[model samples]
Target: MAYVITSSCIGKKVGECAQVCPVDCIQEGEEMFFIDPDVCIDCGACEAVCPEAAIYPEEEVPEDEKRFIQLNRDFFHRD
Candidate 1:
């Protein structure tokens, strides 16, 4: 599964994860950063580098943070 960027990243456009992503799948959001599921290589680099711990695997997304999965998907779908 792909990694998803959660709400905790809102207003915290930290770019550490983006800096480490090899596929360049991470995209800037209105507040946080979103990982394009289609482009992510499932490398887990984003999750390892995120300062806010806002990145998580699609299947491991918590109940409260589940919206991020769709949010990440929609961000790219709309493109």
Candidate 2:
């Protein structure tokens, strides 16, 4: 499963996760960073480095941030 970046990342573009991602799957959004699930290797590297603890495994995404699951997936699927 891929890791999902949630709303906790909003207004908190710390970028540490992006810096450590081996696949370069992380992309910048208007207010935060998103993990491209199609490209992500599930390495968990980003989760270790994220200062906001905004990263979670897709199945483990918090109830409050469930929408980010689709948001992250959609970001990569969009043209």
Candidate 3:
């Protein structure tokens, strides 16, 4: 499953995750960074380097932060 970037990263586009992402799936947003699920390799590299602890597997994201899974998708799919 793809990794999701949660609210903890909303205002912190620190980009440590992006820097370590081998597939370059992470993209900068106005307020944060979003993982392109379509491009993600599910390698977990981004999650390992996130200092904010904001990255989680899509299925493992905490209940309270699950909205981020959709948010990440929306960020890339918005028309």
Candidate 4:
């Protein structure tokens, strides 16, 4: 995964990120938005516009907030 939407977005998903995403890889969820890792092209446009500052590149994700990486994956891949 490249960018992960963290807890900061839990209740503040404004959808601007989705609009800016060239690939339309960001999906709205009950709790937050999940970026489809496979669909995302890593363009970083969404990250630049997120008002909540909830998006982070995988390598730059804070250590404690890393769980969102899996959260994003499971959002689309859950059984």
Q: Which one wins on lDDT?
A: 2
The residue ranges of model 3 lying beyond 4 angstroms of the native Cα positions read none
lDDT of each: 0.92, 0.93, 0.92, 0.91
Q: Write model 2 residue lDDT over 1-79, tens digit each, in one string.
A: 8999999899989999999999999999999899998899999999998889999999999899999998998887888
Residue by residue across 1-79, what tens digits does model 3's lDDT show? 7999998898988999999989899999999999998989999998899989999999999999988888899988989
- Tell me how many clashing residue pairs each candidate has: 0, 0, 0, 0
Against the correct fold, how does model 3 do in TM-score? Answer: 0.94
Better of 1 and 2 by TM-score: 1
Deviation from native of the Cα of residue 17 in model 1, angstroms: 0.8
Residue 24 local lDDT, model 1: 97
Per-residue lDDT tens digits for candidate 4, residues 1-79, read 5789999999888999999999888999997899988888888999999999999998899999999999898888988
lDDT by residue (tens digit), candidate 1, 1-79: 7999999899999999999999999989788889999999999988998989989999999999998899989998994
| lDDT order of candidates, top first | 2, 3, 1, 4
Cα deviation of 38, candidate 2, in Å = 0.7
RMSD of each: 0.9, 0.8, 0.8, 0.9
